[model samples]
Every structure is written in C-alpha cells, then in structure tokens.
Target: MKKRSFADLFFLLFVVYIVLPVVATMLYAFAGKWNKTILPEGWTLKWLATLFQDTAFIQAFGRSVLLSGGAVIIALLAIVPAIFVIVLYFPKYEKWIQAAVVMVYSFPGVILAVGLIRVYSQFGVPMIVVVLGAYVIGILPYIYQGTRNSLRNVDARQLLDAAQLLGASKMQAFRKVLLPTVYPGLFAGALLSFSVLFGEFVLINLVVGSRFETVQIYLMKKLSTSGHIASAVVFIYIVLMGILTFIIAKLTKQAKGATNV
Candidate 1:
C-alpha cells in the first residue's frame, strides 16, 4: 500500500511538472491582459479570434497541413514498401538499408540544407521539390523505426508458409496478409512523421526561405514581434497535438484489440 501510494504520488508529480506550463500558457492565451500581473486581468476569446483571422497565420497553417500531410503520404508509400521488401525478401541487406535510412537523421539540418541548395541550384529543382525533400529527410527515422517496431508482431515465417501452402503468390500474400498485420504500425509511423514535419522549421526555413512559410515559421515571426499572439499560437499547437495524440492512441488500441481478438 505504501509503495503504491509513493508511486502514485511520483506519477502525479511528473504529470504536474509536464502539464502546469501547458495549462498556464493555455490560460494566458485567453487572457485579455497578461502583462504586469500575477494573474490574468480577465479571460476573453479575442486572442483566439485574432489568431484565426490573421491572413498570414491562416496561409501558414494551410501550408503546414499540406506540407506535413503530403510528406507523410509520400514517406509511407516509399518506406512501408521498402521495409516490407527488406523483411520479406532482402533480409540480407536489412542492415545496410536501415543504416541508410537512419543516416538521413544523422545529417545536420544546416549541412543538408547547404548541400541541397548546391545540388538543386545546379539542377534547377523547384521550391516544391525542396519542401518535399526537407519533409522526407527530416522525418525518415521516425517512420523507419516505427515501421520496424510494428513489424515485430507479424510472424514472417508463418506468413510465408501460409502463402506457400495456399499456392498464393509472394506478392498476393504480402499484399493481403503481411500488409494488414503491419498497417497499424505504418499508420502510427505516418502520424508521427506528420507530427514531426508539422512543427519542422529549420530545414524549410533554410532551404525554401521566404518562398515557404509553415506554421512554425509564422509562430516564430509572431513570437519575435508579439509575445501574446505567439503564446496563443503555441497554445493552439499544443491543443492540436493533443487531439492528434488522442486519436492515434485510440486507433492503435483498436487495432491491437482487433488483432488480439
């Protein structure tokens, strides 16, 4: 009983430490006057209203959605198949492939940006190519690791044997059986990649410059000029992430339960 109580207290403390700042900042978002005060003077929705009305913010938000969404789709389409191939067929080259994927994360963003600029400048790549490249390279590790982890639950030998026994072709077996089993992980990876790319700023800022303005860039600009509006944007981002996390948790849970049942 005493140990349980101590563990509960510790967990509560950890949660409080993590959540208090978020709570405070979210409250500040609704503050009519947050300056020169211990507490907000009053609460109002005007900050949120203004935040939603800003044309630059709106455009940046849309761009973030587009960039992150497209990046995740492209990442999944590319990575999932590659992982499946590595797992099912090219097991001999798994280490090399994984090392290559992981190396993408190891490259410093600034260095990568410089190299990309040099090559793209010579090749005359468009802004869209640069944006997509940033998104893919930045989030590659997250998707790769997540997909690898998700593949653990799937029994590869069993899948291959079942396919052979049923006279099903390798492609059909993979498409029908292996793909379904690992889809939860793929979905998780996609969501994670999307989340990472959503808040990503460094690569995009360096590569695309003013040609692109994502949510994070817009928020940074606001922060430098208007702290309150910046706080509001941060609050919105927190809320958005929370919603996405909740959805991912629910979906993952449902998937696991279905598989178990």
Candidate 2:
C-alpha cells in the first residue's frame, strides 16, 4: 500500500506537471484579465477573435500551412519511393541514410541556415525555396523512420512477388501493391513532419523573414506586443496539433488493422 501510494503520487505529479502549463495557457488565452489569482479573473474570446480577424495572422497561418504542406508533399513524392526502394531492394544503402539523418540532427539550424545562405546566395536561387528544400531534408528522418517501421511490419518482398506472379511488372507491383499497403502507416510520418515544420522558426526566419510570414514568425513578433494574442496563437496551435495527433493515432490503428488482414 505504501509503494502503491507513492507511485500514485508520482504519477499524479507527472500529469500535473505536463497538464498545468497547458491549462494555464488555455486560461490565459481566454482570459479577460488574470491578476493575483489562481484562476483567471474573467474570460473572453476577444483574443481569439482578434487573432482570426488580423490579416497578418490569417496570412501567416496560410503560409504555414502551405510551407508545411508543400514540404511534406515534396518529401513524399521524392523521398517515399527512394525509401521504399532502399528498404525493399538496396537495404545495404540504408546505413548511409542513417548516417545522413544523424548528421542532419547534429547540425544546428543556425549553421544550416548560414550554410544555405552562403551556398545559394551566389546562385540567385530563391531563399524561400532553399528553406523549403531544407524543411524537406529536416524531416527526412521522420519520414524514413515512419516508412521503415511500416515496411518492417509488412512483408513487402512477398507482396511484390505475389503481385509479379499475377502478371504485374516490377513497377506496377511496387506502385500498386507495396506502396498502398504501407501508405497509411507512412502517412503518419508526413503528419509528424508537417507538425514539426509548422512550428519551425529558425530556418524560415533566417532564410526569408518578413517576406514569408509563417505562424511561428508571426507569434514571435506578437510576443512583445500582447500576451493574450500570443497565447491565443499557442492555443490554436495546440488545438491543431491535437487534431493531427488524433488523426495519427487513427491512421496507426488503421495501419495495424490492415497489416493483420
């Protein structure tokens, strides 16, 4: 009983530690004013209203969606096939990919941004595109891990063989059979990538600042002006991520179910 009580107390503290900040932030977002109190003095939606009505916020939100979505799509188109081929065919090359992912993690965003600027500034390539390219690369590990895990759960070689035995060409077998089989699981990776890229600030800020106003940049600018508005942005961002997390959970379950079948 003593051990059980101690464990329960620890778990309770852990949950409080994680949830209290979120609850406080949510309260702050909706708060009319909070001063010298444990709870908000009053509640209102003006902060959220202000956030949505502001053209800059709306634009930032849209650009964030576009940048994150575009990066994820490009990674999917360019990286997914390469990953499939690597895992299913040239798995010996997987170690090289692992090394690259490790290197990507080791490099700080500031270094990557400076390197990008120095390398691409001479070529007249748009910095936004460069940032987009880097975003795709930044997310390589997430996509690769998600796709790799999905592929591991699946007997992709057997699926390819079975498809080929049914008169499908190698290309057709890969495209129609193996790809769809692992797509749901792998798609979770894209969502994770999007979430990560959506919150990214350093690369985009250094690459293209006022020109491309992503949500994070907007939030950064707002932090000095109004706490409520900033909190509102954070609240909405949390909601958006919560939705994506829920979708990821669903996709993962669906992937597992399909695999079992």
- Local accuracy of candidate 2 as per-residue lDDT tens digits, 1-261: 999999999999999999999988888999987899989889999999999999999999999999999999999999988988888889899999999889889999999999999999999999999999999999999999999989988899889999999999999998898888898988899999999999999999998998999999999999999999999999999999999999999999988889985
Q: How do the residues 27-51 of candidate 1 rate in per-residue lDDT, one tens digit apiece? A: 8888887778888999988878899
Candidate 2: regions farther than 4 A off:
none
* Residue 156 Cα positional deviation in candidate 1, in Å, after optimal superposition: 3.2
Candidate 2, residue 234: CA error in Å?
A: 0.4
Best candidate, TM-score: 2
C-alpha lDDT values of all predictions: 0.80, 0.93
> Using alpha carbons, what is the TM-score of model 2?
0.95
Clashing pairs in model 1?
Answer: none
